[model samples]
Target chain A: EAEVAQSPRYKITEKSQAVAFWCDPISGHATLYWYRQILGQGPELLVQFQDESVVDDSQLPKDRFSAERLKGVDSTLKIQPAELGDSAMYLCASSSRGTGYGEQFFGPGTRLTVL
Target chain B: AQSVAQPEDQVNVAEGNPLTVKCTYSVSGNPYLFWYVQYPNRGLQFLLKYITGDNLVKGSYGFEAEFNKSQTSFHLKKPSALVSDSALYFCAVRDKGGAGGGNKLTFGTGTQLKVEL
Candidate 1:
């Protein structure tokens, strides 16, 4: 079974530092999603991309966070001047298009910790 | 807004016993519900989904969920539990309304299931 890929399974950074995480969705999957999972909570959507175009980013904290998928195959999420509250498990997921009921495949996720 | 709720924060069960995790949802139009499991340091693993199908949906790891439309609930259940089944579980929903509504999923807080020997 094809799976979504993520890099830097774990990262530790001090406050005010910059950090970035990468993800590669399954081949042929057109919708990609970025989510943040806090301890003891479910994953929260940060951004959604549909073939290189952003579909939704209502929950994203734009002042410090940025995300991009230039070619639509892979994506990167960055935080400039990371804050302590930014510490969480960053997960990436992908699914086929035209079907909202399709199952989503999730990446292992990059756990970020800010000191 | 679409939302999911896992009423129980934690559920404890002995090995070989049946387990159930409660989930309720609110959506504007038809509801697309999903259940996922998360182990320590791992990502969310898809367990099952309910979308215009039989009320009872079976999924991986000997798990199943019953979608109750009248009650607006989709509860995850396993006939028999194992130690390996212990993990954090989440419920999510996608509401069909406008473009934004069906494009993204809203998740619940999550429920921790512990299967003890």
Candidate 2:
């Protein structure tokens, strides 16, 4: 069973600092996604990537958050000058294809705690 | 805009009893619904999905979900619940109307099910 891999399962940082999370999707997956799950709320998609390019990032906070998937394999999400409100579980997921409604496989996620 | 709704915040069921976690969705076209389970400190695991065909779709961990188009619901069910089944369950849907193409899934608020022995 190929699993989505994530690094730095836990992270803590003071406000106004920078933080980054990494994700490696399952092999052969063509689409990748980043989601933020706040306390007591469901995961909200922050960005979507098709291969090496970003398809949608409308929900992401442009001033502080950014994500990239280079070579269409591994992805990195970075937060600059993190705020307390930026604390949440950053999840990475991938699907085999962007069409035909394929089910996504998720990573363990990196829990960010900004104080 | 596709969205999923999980009405109950929590559900309690005794071990060996039948269980059901309710889910409803709003979509523009034919819906592709899914159910996922998440344990503490872990990621969401795919359970099952409904794309087309039979309304009853069986999935992992002895779980199943029934799709009711008229009611616009896809509720997860288990014939016999176990203590190991206690976890946070989420329902999701892919936006059929969005122009961003495919592969975007919107999740529900999640339902925490506690199967007590």
Candidate 3:
């Protein structure tokens, strides 16, 4: 079975520092997602990508967070000037595009801690 | 707005016993409901989904969920619980009205299931 790939499984950064996480979704999957999972909370969507285009970034904090999926094969989520509240497990997921009921495949996630 | 709720924070069940995790969703238009499981230190894994069809939806690892549209509920079930099934479970939903909902999923808080011997 193909799996979603994520790198830098853990990161510790000081507040006000910049950090980035990477994800490579399964091949042929056209929809990619970035989510933040705070402790004891479910994953919250930060952005969604269709092919190489961003479909949604409504919940993403534009002032500090940015995401890109150039070429649509993989994606990167970056946060500049990280805040303490930004500490959480960053997860990446992907699924077949244009399906009403497609299953989403998830990556192991990168745990970010801001001091 | 679309949202999902897992009423129970935790559920304890003995091995070999049946188990059920409750989930309720609120969304406009037709809703696509989903169930996912997360093990310790791991990301969420897809379990099942209910789109348009019979209310009962079967998924991976002997898990199933029943979608009750009138009540706005989709409850996950397992006939025989195993220690391996112990994990955090989440319920999710997507609203058809939302733009490009085909890509985004809204998840519930989550329910931790502990199966004891």
Candidate 4:
């Protein structure tokens, strides 16, 4: 089974520094999602993409956070001047097509810690 | 708006016993429900899903979920439990009438299931 791939499984950085996480979805998957999972809480959707076009980014803090799936195959999420509260697991998931009605494959996630 | 509720923060069950993790949802239009499990330092794993079905949906790893339209509930269940089953479980609902093309998934806080051996 093809699984979603993520990089920098663990990261620790200073509060004023920048951090980025990468994700490569399973082949042929057109829908991708970025989520943030805080400690003791469920994951929250930060941004969603459909074939490199952003479908939703209502919850994304655009001033400090940005995500891009240039080719719609791989994506990168970046946070500038990371805050302590941003310390959490950043997960990437992908579905074969639309998100309304199918199972999603999730990557192992990149755990970020800002001190 | 679509929402999922997991009332219990934790559920303890002995190995070999049947186990259940409760989930209730509220949605407009139609309901699409899902259950996922996560171990420490990992991403969420798909366990099961409830779309338009026969009210009973079977999924991976000997797990099943029953959809009760009247109660607006879809609870995860297993015939027998194992210590390895211990993990953080999440229930999610997709917003069928949501903005931005309508595919947003809203999740519950999560429930920790501890299957003791």
Candidate 5:
């Protein structure tokens, strides 16, 4: 089965350090998403991309977080000067279509820990 | 904004017994509901979704969900449970209105299901 790919399954860094995660969506998928999952809470959307353009990033913390999908196939999320509260599981998901009705497929995710 | 709720924090069921996980949603217009499962240290996996047709929707791994419009609920159920079925389940919702031309999903806190031997 075709699946979304994520790199750096686990990451540990001190607070104030910079970290980045990468994701490659399933082939032909046009919509990609970045989400953060706390220990006991469901995932929350950080950003959404349609093709090479950003569709929504209302919930993303602009001051410290940034995400990009230059070619629309692969994406990267970065957090500079990471904070302890930023520790969580970062998930990447993709859907075949950009419509709200399509079901999304997820990647294994990258676990981030800030000391 | 669309939102989802998982009333129960945890549910325990014995193996071979039927199991259910409750979910409710709120949306301005119609809703697109989805159920997802997550194992330890993993990402969310899509289980099923309810769009517009039938009230009962069957999904992967012998799981199913019923959409009740009046009650605004979409609960996940399985006829029989297995030890491997123990995991964290989440319910998510998206408004059909397409407010920002984005397919944003709002997820519930999540429910932990334990299928004991």
Candidate 6:
């Protein structure tokens, strides 16, 4: 089974530093999502991309966070001046189009910690 | 707004015992419900989902869920539990009538399931 790929399984950064995470969705998947999971809470959507265009980013903190899927196959999420509260698991998921309400396949997330 | 609720913070079940992880949801229109499991230091894994037909939906790892529209709940269950089954479970929901073919999922605070040997 093809799986979404993520890099930097763990990251530690000082507050005010910049950090970035990468994700490569399963081949042929058109929809990609980025989520943040707090210690005791379920994941929350940060951004969604359809092909190379952003579909939704209502919950993303645009002031500090930015995400891009330039070629529509791989994506990168970057945070400038990371904060302590930004520490969490950053997850990436993907699903193919044409599948009505397709179930998303998730990648092993990148754990970010800000000190 | 779409939302999900996981009532229990934790559930304990012995190995070989039937286990259940409860979930309830609220949505504006019809709901697309899903169940996911997470192990330590990993991402959420899809378990199953309820779209339209059949109230009962079976998923990976011999797990199943029943969608009760009247109750607005989709609970995950397994006939027998194993020690490896212990993990965090989450329930999520998306409104079927949401705009732009909404794929946004509102997830509930996860429930910790501990299946001891």
TM-score for candidate 3, please give it: 0.96
Error of 6 at B18 (Å): 0.8
Give the per-residue Cα lDDT of candidate 2 at A95: 87
Over A25-100, each residue of candidate 4 has an lDDT whose tens digit, in order, gives: 9999888999999998889999989999998999999999999999989999999989999999999999887455
| Candidate 2 structure quality by residue, lDDT tens digits, A1-115 | 8999998999999999999999999998888889999977889999988889998898999999999998999999999989999989999999887445758899999999999
TM-score each candidate.
0.96, 0.97, 0.96, 0.97, 0.97, 0.97
Instruction: Report DockQ per prediction, comma-separated.
Output: 0.68, 0.76, 0.70, 0.73, 0.72, 0.71
Q: Which window of ten consecutive residues has the lowest lDDT sum in model 2 chain B?
A: B95-104
For candidate 2, the docking band is: medium
**What's the C-alpha lDDT at position A17 in model 2?**
97
Q: Quick one: RMSD of model 5?
A: 1.2
TM-score comparison, 4 vs 6, better candidate: 6
Clashing pairs in 2: none
- Which stretches in model 3 have alpha-carbon errors above 4 Å? none
- The global C-alpha lDDT for each of the candidates, from Candidate 1 onward, is 0.91, 0.92, 0.91, 0.91, 0.92, 0.92
lDDT of 3 at A101: 70
Q: Decide which is better by lDDT, 1 or 2.
A: 2
Q: Which one wins on DockQ?
A: 2
Per-residue lDDT of candidate 5, residues A1-115 (tens digit): 9999999999999999999999999999999999999999999889988998988888899999999999989999999989999999999999987445858899999999999
Model 1: per-residue Cα lDDT over B2-87, one tens digit each: 88999999999999999999999988878989999999988889998888869999999999999999999999999999999999
Candidate 3 residue-wise lDDT at A66:
98
How is the predicted docking of candidate 1 categorized under the CAPRI scheme?
medium
